[model samples]
Target: MIINQSIITDIKNIIVQSKEKAIRAVDHQRTLMYWHIGKRIFEEEQEGKERADYGTYLIKLLSEQLQPEFGSGFSPRQLERYRQFYRVFPIASALRTQLSWTQYKLLLSVDNEEQRDFYIAETIKNNWTSRQLERQIYSNLYERLLVSNDKENVLSVAKNEKFPSDAKEIIKDPMYLEFLGLKRETSYYEKDLENAIITHLQEFLLELGNGFSFVARQKRIHIEGDEFFADLVFYNRLLQCFVIIEIKTHKLTHQDIGQLQMYVNYYDRMEKLPHETPTIGILLCADKNDAVVKFTLPENQKQIIASQYKLYLPTEQQLLEEVNKELESFEEK
Candidate 1:
């Protein structure tokens, strides 16, 4: 029997979509099953166990028996993971089946309940993969978000709900650049840094946080037929706008802000959708003066954001100092 062209096309489309749905359903079911298994194991382990010996022996015996049968996935360490998984995700209903075990494991690392919840909401909202979630957590996404936003505002953003229109509302301070793998005090051309970011684009996107999709690097823009190249260009799904980024190897300067503003304005007028939010500009600088950043633009400026990038992770003391200073400043204001 010969199928009509339209009928064949429709059949193929239906099969493709059905397979996709089936895969997602299977994954969700598997995740829920693991959760249940973990919960049962934890409950059994905790039943009238006031002693450490029973717990230790139980894991050891299970590991020995399960390892030969089930192999590496059932090691003693993995059993501990299952136990901790149940502990961390006590409420099975609250678990996001779309998120993998790796993402949930990362969430368990966050000791703060509120912060963990925020990341979880954002992860689900954005449909981030395990690697993406890990990158955001390592980059201190929650702390940076909390820098200038109040608890309510931050929570709302994390929940993919409405957020106030402010530069600080969207920008992550001291933006993590560990993906670039550049050493401190090293001199590299802007092209080199851009290439590194491109090489590890997924990690870069995670560090950049939600909504960013890379459009191009060294994107050209024209003003009065004079060409200027943007270091990077991205479109933010959340903000529904273009993001023009400029890279600066030196401390952020007034000139850098002006240049970025020009690009932002150009994008707004030339490329932005009429209903889209204003184009957002970011200056990724090696260093920044917080006071200078405050005074460089209009007090109510919402389109442009300047942030410092660190090649290596900040020391705990440095992080503490920055956090304390920001908290103090907030208190003063």
Candidate 2:
């Protein structure tokens, strides 16, 4: 029997599409299974309100009984995780199937309800992978947003209380590139770091937070006779604008701000769609002096922002220092 070539190609496409959907279905079912298991465990452990001691003992006993049969995923620590998971995602029906266990795990670690909800919405909106979700949460995307935008604006964005017309809504103060594993002490060229980020672009985008779609690497632009290249170009669907990122391997400077401003202007004037909002510029640098940045930029500067980057995660003491500093600033305000 002779098979028609066109029919054969169509059959192959159908098979491929079917397989993809089947895999997604399997993943969804598996996630639901885990959630239901967590729910069961949580309900069984809840003796009464204000019964932490009793709950702890119950988890220990439950783990001991379940561990041998269920293996490592059912250990005492994991049981506690399950309980916390249930608490974080109380409504099983509302839990997104697209999100993996790792994403859920990362989300459960976050204590801020508004921030958590923001991430959840962004995750679903962006279809972020688990690794991506972990990186954003680790980078303290919410805190970065708070520092970058007005307090009222930031909180409103987090709660989805209001939507902005521009990319400014989601632009963070500091774009964390810790996943690149670059040394803090060793000096490197901006291009070198930019190349590395390009190589690990997926991880970098995830760290950059939600709604970021890579548009170009070393995106070129010509002004009069001079040539300039943006370190990275991305489109944020949530914010609805082109994001021009200028990567600096060294300390941020006024020149960096000037370059980014020029790029933002070019995109806004020459490239932006009639319906699209203005382009947002970000200067991602190794180190930043907040006072210097404040003085360097014009007062009432709305578009350009300089953010400090860190290679490693902050320690508990560092986090405490940040909190205390923010509190002090709040008091002064």
In terms of TM-score, which candidate is strongest?
A: 1
lDDT of each: 0.81, 0.76
TM-score of model number 1: 0.81
Model 2 weakest lDDT span, ten residues long? 165-174
By TM-score, how accurate is candidate 2? 0.78
Candidate 1, residues 1-333: lDDT per residue as tens digits?
786899889999999999987877777776676677678778777883887687777877888998998788778887877777787778888877677766777887898888888888988887887877777776677777788888789888788678546657767887878767788778987788888888989878777776789999999877787999999999887778888889888888888898898899888888988899898999888888878877988897888888888887676578768877887888798
**Candidate 1 residue pairs in backbone clash:** none
RMSD of each: 3.6, 3.9
Give each model a TM-score. Answer: 0.81, 0.78
